[model samples]
Target: MSKNNKEREVTAGPVKGEFISPQELNDIEERTDALPPQEDFWKPPVRFGSVPVEKEPLGWDRRRGFRKLFPVVSLPTQVVERVSFGHPELEPNRLFWGDNLHVMRQLPSESIDLIYIDPPFFSGRQYNVIFGDQNELRSFSDIWEGGMPGYLIWLNARLYEMKRLLKKTGSIYVHCDWHASHYIKVEMDKIFGYGNFINEIVWCYETAGKSKKTFSRKHDVILLYSKTDDFYLDVSKSPMPRKRNKHMRVGVDENGREYEEKTDAKTRKVYRWYFDEGRLPFDYWTDIQFINWEAKERIGYPTQKPEPLVERIIKVSSNDEDVVADFFCGGGTSLAVAQKLKRKWIGCDQSRVAVALTADRISRLIEEEIGKIFSVPDFTVEHWGIYEADRLSKMPLDQFRAFILRAFGAVPDDSQTGIHGMKGAIPIYVGEPNQRSQVTAKEVEAFANAIRKTIRYQQDNLRDGIMLAWAFRPDAVQAAERLRDMEITDLNFVRLEQIRIDHPRFREHVAALSTDHADYANFLTFVQPPKVEVGWKRLATRSYIQADINKRTY
Candidate 1:
């Protein structure tokens, strides 16, 4: 699974070769599944087989009468940036900068094969603010408000969406620790059926922060769960080499391979086992070490996991060309590893700084590490709920119009001349992508005439119109006002509203949602790109400047 074989070799069992073939492994797995639960434990699982898929946004637990709810909202993506590797024809993998719950809601159901998320660990400490961004800070604050229950509720909302996005045969690996693993497990059981539980992997590593009062807490827990009963599993993908045992009776087979013989005393049947086949893994893993500050893969993210850790999970869960996703991408360790492993990936992070850093990290890998055989040629970084006006102004004309229509919750209809879209019996016109280009009186007149020629207008079904642009010329505003006044007295009355892109009413689609929570304040916000200025001055004399400022351009 990793380059450092010795460091990742947790154990080599004495009995390995007996469970190599597919038939034997399948038979063993079947028998294990048929066994009954322990008498002292194992309560019956909740029967959610008939709970319609549309109700996935509704949360529940094993006990009745208690429900945690999530609102199903669709905030489409805005392409912020696209990193290219010379292949323009390939579709770009997506990286989103937004709340993952809203982002995942827009994704197609059952599209991803593997999902690995490392969300906030609920440490309730200041160090969790790694990027110092308002969005990241808000997420951490919201989760820690009501203590354990609050944290679980916040995580369960996203977890429910993740369950909807995962394929029927997919797997999810959640990396957490002692803080709230037990609570999360019960919630996951309620979300993903309890019978689909896979393993509670213990990743052991030694680091500083040893305590004298109790045993040093050095291990992190990884809870793995599947979406369905027939999920895929291929342990041989992560092969573990075993050592030879001298006590076993070893002999060479006819094919010049080493083998061990096991004889059934009653039937006198001898079964041959091969040594080259791989061994199964233990739930307790100590081979892979934790990433220190000086590690090469470390990019300064506080909760960044090692690439090898994600690599093993991806290799075992998904195949090549399969889609992998990471909803809480801290430093994008999972995404980077997936790209190198030839798997298409999608990643989302709420912090702008983390998204920027993750994009840079992946770009560096594309330029340096992933060589000629790189199959992943492009990926796009998109923003949901939050948008960049500077980037939006630079998009192509058609792209900008489509994005505007989607953002306004309107259906784009480019078939009619001068009318770009419609929203509930109202015609809409979109201006140019360049913000400096203002809407003209001629354009407004043309849209009015075009709508008058439409069947909906002749039948008296459409009487309203909305014009969206960065700015409207005075002549255009006057034309719209004149049309509104003149048409109201005539047989067909038309109301046209000339609205700028920066108008608060432009965000009415998202603003009308339930705003009972304070976190919705940042959604549907338009942020301007920072303005940078550079100036140079003549500094002929070195003695005139300080040592620090002297090194910079003057």
Candidate 2:
């Protein structure tokens, strides 16, 4: 976290203006006197029963971890936009703009090879409200309602999903700080298991701040856990620079290469160390520093981390072409590092601004950072629960049709010219992708004829047909009404339902994907992108004379 986001520390002991009044001291004394005892004493041994973490806070609840938590309801994603660097044949990396829990639910289980999440620490409001997004604000409020317990429960559910999403050989790195790292450690143990716990790395950095009353907090804790005991880790992929002590003898080998030798006292054997073969890294890392304001990598994110730090974690845990995921991706440090390392990456953030920033950062990487751009696979900007209706309306005809069909839970068909897909026995015909394009009367008649030609309609006698579009023309509705009335004379017997994209029927399709949890009602929805206009103006420049300022100060 940045210095501006640091919480104002308040001390309890006596200082210049800080004092405990006489009345308050008297009350405290009275309360202390009323206590039964303060002395330490030996008590009788008590027998205890072990309870699994599935039952929660106290482990008494009958419901398990996922059952008690709000389900990450699976929803169809709309490929509203794409960022490609000329490779459409390869699988594109994914960038999701939605709650990560739900996005993870939609991903296949055991797909990710490594995950690094920098979730919001339970520090306070200022730290959690990084983007001021509605989802983040609501989540922080829920976290503070019950204090520590509420925050743990909210995080435990996501951790459980990450565990399920991780491959058996996958590893996870959770970044946090002093505020709630200990509590999170206990909860993570419960979710990932005590045996799976790996390392508790301390990331030390230098910053300009000191506390006179107490020790300054300068480091952050990164908890590492594996999905299973067989997790992959290659230390040689990223090793520290070799260092030698003054006691070691330095000399040159026969090839004139500089080398250092150390004698083993017990065996009286000499061992030589070379500079090219670097030393393995340690759990305590201090070489990497924080991103200063003047640093080019600083992209104005309140809690953005340095790239070198993220690179170390990725290099050790994953191999080339492996999948790396970051559920709480803020300024895209992890994604950019993964890209540079040649790993397939997935990033998700609830804040639209955060997701947009991530896409821009990766786009820059593809264009300028890596000179060999063609090798990089293109990535897609997908929206899960929150959709972009305007973007969808502007997509290509085939793409828009596929989006609507997938949202409607229908299978796409290309056998017929007019028939776009099928929803059970009923045939579906989609209008043009442009929102202004309306369903015409001629199109309705054509869809009816197309449905009648289908084997299901001819043999199964399926008489239902559906036309979905932005809006239907008045004649189109009238045409459907006329078809229903003339059914007695027509042997084909077709009934067409004209539905607008914004109709209640489409909302039902979205709502049908929600879990039993009530909070999921607002889970899947389409919202127009926020309107933003940029303007700039030259400001009057003011100059100050050093002589005049010095004279005035004196």
Candidate 3:
């Protein structure tokens, strides 16, 4: 919601450049005069024998049809590529890079079983990327010009879509902090109904910082709400360690299990506590620790929640293979935990870097957990508001040319003789619209000729030039090679592969693990499956070394 300095300020009354001619104004006045006078035009029509409507909920933004605020750009539907690790028949999970509102709209209603979103908490600050090679410096702003109202509007729109996506028995968990949490709770009550409100979990963690103004804010609020009263919840999955009673001593039962009994002083009632009865987790959580810098699970992402935290939520809310979704999946912690728990997941984030890191992290998890070679959990990577192959093929010549140039980080230059744009003095020429077909030798020769002309006729100093196309024919590659040998012009013909690599839509395929069956078998025999816990320390160290070697070799 934070506005950039370059953003234009919105004003009321009339938009600039919108002018009504005198004749046009006169026509409007004439039309108004022709109509017969009636009752107050703004008054609501009276209804008889209709169900009495209750007063509209207070604090609710009754403005409907706000989807118009965001123009829907037609994006090409990407083909879902399967990259199976263990189960090929299982429905592939999905990872999307776009606004969650648009992505949720595309999903079918009443399909998802569980939804967990850790959206921006209206912190009035920018959450910048702390790690990741590409987007380390990028930041997401939580500031809103309209303040709480604007934040509510933005979140309410997405929550409305999410509610529709949830099944009758589905549940949602919204994570937030003190800022705007009260407002969000009110908005959620209006949307999900107060009757459906569940527990509000307090996730408490220990950190270094302390506030001098008041008590240190050490906990976050996670609001849990179900689509309906009849929702799924397995609290038994997340049990806490039972605390010992100071008033009673341990006694042995008939089953040889330790038990403790305490007599209430006021009520004179005896209560027995067995060691085997696992205690249910309270609404307030402090068992799970926060991700520290030295933790192995730390991926160096800002605000990355610990895996155990999300794992508990997933376990409690969803069954195996149930579809779970995280709209604001910053580092994909929810998606990764869902996958590990054997749940189908859908995650979306606007940051390409976050998506990239999530894909890489998930691939490594698949490798380490499922022990698959050259495989990852099957999932599709998609970009919204970007042209796909089908749409690109149908686009007009000029528009398509412009799109290609812009996608390649170049400006379209019709003024240039042959080059489309200049990328830091390097002339870029977009090949003909061939729809993934090969670029022929004739096309390559024409580009070569243009470069030669620039060097000879224009007296222009040209070091190198590039030709972008769908694919290059063998002869075309040979021609470019021949020209490079002659030193006339160093023309590099870049094909779709290079472009796709540079602008990757899917996670790069992980290298196949070395298939040393005998060695693996020997190690397994020595460690034994039953003793894995005892030997994991040594095994993990060896695995880490192997992974490092593979990283270097690959």
Candidate 4:
């Protein structure tokens, strides 16, 4: 029969394919083509008649949650400086200033014992609150244009890396709210598996406000999950008070401890409950309070979590000396709690203000809390994606001047012709140094002119002016000395040490340079000011002066 004219019969029999006739093969191909399209299949095939080949999509997944995207690429980081506090013998904790996703990817797999992160919720708003210093402001937009899908993609990428860093027996607590809690839970289940989910804790609190349109939303959901089935959790550490049942009779034990006993009505079994043994905490948590504005723990950072909440989690999920981590360490609450609990910690944040606040807060905590017996916690501060010297050299003169001024904690003055900004009462003149050995004579002349102009403009008293550069020529320094002697303005020829002092990792960089130049070593020693503790009574009697002049100079 002709190929097109022949009627191919489809049979439900195993066709041996070792050697088939050409006509039979043609018939099989034709039969396959005649079958319905795979997309039109009624039901997707199940694995082992139970497990699903593909996950069933929730309503949000179909509209906005899951998405198809390329894999995330992690960037490298360079360690800038290591800081040590009261106890220098303990292993230094790590603080990275960069994208947490990239930083977490660089961490060793299965190294972290516990992870607690309070990432930004999809609140569709911008936060631009300044916490510590006047110039230090943390502004970030958490609104996603692609809505839920984009938010999930951004979060899921980090979560994947977080899972890799978590040990098999480690646990993670993800803090979220009603904004995207349902979506977050679904994605977490898809990554960590539903069987490993431990709890969906509801943290309820009583605030002052109420919504008239609906019930007041006062609770946040904390999804707890383990990396594997064999996870570690100490529920005994987080015990709550339990009231005695009315049917139970109170009695004294042999050791004089009070106890209560009751008989089950259905099972007819007797049970003894000790008064000393507190009840285990349920998933609903209401005891912990939020950080109010007047709270001592409040560091002026909005969205700062309470310390007790993190303390309970750390105590329950991890032991002493275990590794703990917080990727979105806003105000460093987790790091502070971890340090107090004697656990090794790693913290990362992209905001410079956050890093600076964390560094300062940790230092103060060591001094006040742990410095009496143990040394302050030793830690390293690292900045990722810093501009190389070559790249910095290529920057425009105005941009370089502004960058140097800002890095040195001085505000750039665009209105003033020669002066960069006023660092305290001193006028700053920044000279351009593009990979040069010394500041040029022309730059020195301009600085002298700027000093003369500033003096003439002020017309009050001869004030000190600072001339900053990478390095100063002997002639330039001599010229500055001459200008200072002239009494027009006391121009001091200082190098970039002033700028380096503001950097968190400046000590390490200065130490590295000190090997080549003994002067750099001396500069490092000169920058270390004497520590002074001031009380309110002293401040009331006299002017409060900060011991660290470098901090106030800016």
Candidate 5:
């Protein structure tokens, strides 16, 4: 059933109406107190069924894998940074990354308004892991070890998580092909309930590959389920189907016969239209097409879905400001369209490659004419925070060190060799969990003596007692021993942990580097049909002959 919604009520059939003598009616009404009340009789009967539940056969996990939750740190709010290329000028609401599982875990519960994920069908590992990397190719061997039952288990866990995260009013669309569509439908029905099952959409597409021996595969199944009865479906935004009458006239003829007829309001011309004309598309859809080489929006990604396709989904299922999420965000197409439509979105993908490409596409779109008109909140051009490193990297080493001492609350000293391997020139020691951000003890010892001497000299000469002197480090306990009774501002260190970077952060850096290695790189690509080459034909024929001989012998 839809989340948090109750089933419709049913009442018992009414008794036959009859007139009786007044005395008899009063006696009957009084005597009828012995009978069960009408409300009690109308209650729903208990459900009865004898259906066996399927159980999975176990014995798969011989070893457990490693799992850790480590926090990632980001620069502070006041730090302003900028980069060229790959970083999108505009921010999208949805992100599609490599691993849907990882992304889904990060999402907040009941945040999304709608979700439509077309995960792989369990159509054999060879077909499912079409991506041609060693990892994906080997995934077939690894996944098949457990078989379809195991596959069901894997999908069930994901579905459970999805159910938990969905809002009460949200909806989900699970896309699949013939291979496992039926099984998935059953599973979905069980999880979301038979009552919540919205539609079984049959999406048909054209296929040029003729199969004389069997039926041509030309359609996919989409199982739509709502979290609750209440959900947004924007009807006005959908395109009107051709061959529909523009207007209808309801009137009665001179014969006193009522009829409803299609008409053009202005011309009053009688129009013939199909019963289904101008109606919202039902479960079976035949208009959408698969991506091809000539498609204008194709960006050379293997699984890049079309813009119009996603755009239609955005318009129909969501409204402006509503959240849209995609866990397996590949090219960020959903997010891009969602942004255009003014919906907030969250997209996740594991592959660094996919994230980078998507970020680049979004950035380029913003640079064009559209970005200026629409601006997403939290992402603004006016206030890119300032990071201390960007400004310090330009200064000379000595001058930089001097500036760091005075600027970051560190004592000025010549004995100090700066901290190493920091992105910024001024190395701010990020403290451990629950500890304040501070400079290390090594630096304090090296610089405090010289910094104190410099301050003492300046203070004695200027008669202004170390006004510019400061110390920035995590452990102020030791610094107190060295600087003793002196004015020292201990700038607390930042906790490096707990910060998370957006998709654009690392992507921008990676994109700036040359990608000449990608061509030679072993990219994971999905393999389509016509896999047979010249050498393979001979091998197949030999195998066929051997199989025939074996069959004959048996």
Candidate 6:
């Protein structure tokens, strides 16, 4: 087992005050007691066994090695609204449109029962890859490259988040190619531990044509790991057939009923013969075929694995109503399977093309024609905050405030007078050059007074307070702090920002458009889904206004 690293490093926004002197810094540091070597910060600890990685040279060894050791760190206690879909009549299936690292960090630890990820394999060639629109391609290469070390770094960061998100009884299946499977296996061992190592399933499929000299490779590795010794594994559904003929029967004559199997070699006792019973499958599997162009589940995407493969995994690792997640959901294969099998699921991908296509595919799969007594869910597609706020805000004022507090990891302050930025998950407000006073302390105090009244009104009426506010701000932190402290006892506040609006120009454009169409008010409130045809123009060149303020990277 690898030793847990105990280095204490602050990796978040700086505190308000700074060290006045070297001695002051040293004194402050000395006075601070080391936090108990924190274990599993996100959720309950999951115990996983490990296994030795197979020795193989990956295409990007150096990059993978770096990633295996130092993964991307996550923002502490930040929250983003979760995106979900599927009809209420059906199970809860979600689709997240952001980075999985952030999403997993927000999720409660040990929550998901099963996870199946088909992460991008670090292959050298990628031309017209599936889900490769301009935006998606940029994100893909940004995450997948820098060679083996880079890929490992990316994978390890995600894995740490997964470790916290998984249930103690949960299991994870990591799918990969020959290019980086070995390195990934090593990383998994370090993260999940060698004791939880389960199976190395070989998904073998046939490829046409013969190799001239070397053997043609046509299989992928599925490394399975469990959270603990006692995990949920439904082996009965997909057990292998027993190879009766392969096992030699003792005490059996050449061809007669007098022959019986030997009970024990030393005892040589005759036992009733039992053969042809199905045996459980081992690590290597070769039955499932890859998706072909003519296959029913084909969705015009390269590297889309068959539904059967995912189905088998979902069935074996989880039960009905159990939540499952797939961060690298390509064509919604996992989502489709999860919906059909009655499991709650969340699938994420960077591509808008993929997201739209996945939504369409899932809808189609659910509506497959059966008979007159067909069933369909009241399906609803949602983006990020607005959709969730629409649903959650329906609760009473106190309840809604609680929801916001829990989600954002910050108490709402009614005093701040501006709409928070929805897409960026930051606190900001709309403003003009002249309306800067809207973010002042006086405004915050006034807003706080209004919230106190609203809380009282809600208490009297037994209803939730639902309202919207927007302002322009020059400083967000000071404004946010003022709001945080301006509260009547037990009555917090929530600030929501418009989703799709970017700059003041976009805000002006939206206001102009909204004035013309009152009925489309709801559409403008939430973040807009990606527009495929949008183009960009370069900004005018200018001299350096200020040096980059980012901390220097070592």
Candidate lDDT scores, in order, read: 0.64, 0.66, 0.61, 0.62, 0.44, 0.50
Q: How close is candidate 6 to the true structure, as a TM-score?
A: 0.56
Best by TM-score: 2
> How do the candidates rank by lDDT, highest first?
2, 1, 4, 3, 6, 5
Residue pairs clashing, model 2: none
Candidate 4 pairs with clashing backbones: 85-376, 86-375, 86-376, 87-375, 87-376
Candidate 6: segments with Cα more than 4 A from true spot: 1-91, 127-139, 241-278, 369-429, 432-554
Model 5, 317: alpha-carbon shift in Å?
Answer: 1.3
> Candidate 1 lDDT, tens digit per residue, 1-554?
11221111111111122111111112223322121122312354476333322222133432321122444333456664566676757766878776777777677678899999997787885433444432223235545766787677778777866876788899999999988887787667666766878999898889878799999999988999998877887877875544466655789977899877667889988866677874566777766788977889976667888887888889999998899999989778999999899899999986555676677667767766674566555777676766655555676788778766655556799888878988777777788877578878888888888888788888874656777666677787777778878772111212112223224443332222212243332234444544211112111110100001001110
lDDT score for candidate 1 against the true structure: 0.64
Give, for candidate 3, the lowest lDDT window spanning 10 residues.
540-549
Put down candidate 6 lDDT per residue, 1-554, tens digits, no spaces. 01232221112211211100001112212422111122321232346443334332122133332223332222222112212222334533556543465445456567789999998787866433344433233234443436676667667767756765678899999999899887887767666766677888898889787787878888899999876677899776766644444355634345543333546678886565533334466777666788877988886666688988888899889997788889878778888887787777777764445655666566545544311134433222323212222333333544444333323333354354333222122232222212112344444444444444443434653222222223323343354454445433221222344333234433332222211211221222222222432123111111101011111111
Q: lDDT for model 6, please.
A: 0.50
**lDDT tens digits by residue: candidate 4, 245-328:** 787898998899888998899999988888788778889888787887788888666678899899989999999889999999
Candidate 2 Cα deviation (angstroms), residue 379: 0.2
Relative to the unseen true structure, what is the C-alpha lDDT of residue 399 in candidate 3, on a scale of 0 to 100? 60
TM-score for model 1? 0.64
Q: Which portions of model 1 miss their true places by more than 4 Å?
A: 1-70, 89-91, 126-128, 132-138, 239-279, 373-375, 394-402, 410-522, 527-554
Q: What is the C-alpha lDDT profile of model 2 across 80-143, one tens digit per residue? A: 4556676667787888876676677667668899999998888766333444432232135545
Which model is ahead, 3 or 5, in terms of TM-score? 3
Off by over 4 Å in 5: 1-51, 55-98, 125-141, 243-278, 377-554
Model 5, residue 408: C-alpha shift (Å): 32
Tens digits of per-residue lDDT, candidate 3, 162-262, equal 88789989999999999978778767766677677899999999999899999999999999999888999999898876777888867888889888888
TM-score order of candidates, top first? 2, 1, 3, 4, 6, 5
Between the candidate structures 1 and 3, which one is better when assessed by TM-score?
Answer: 1
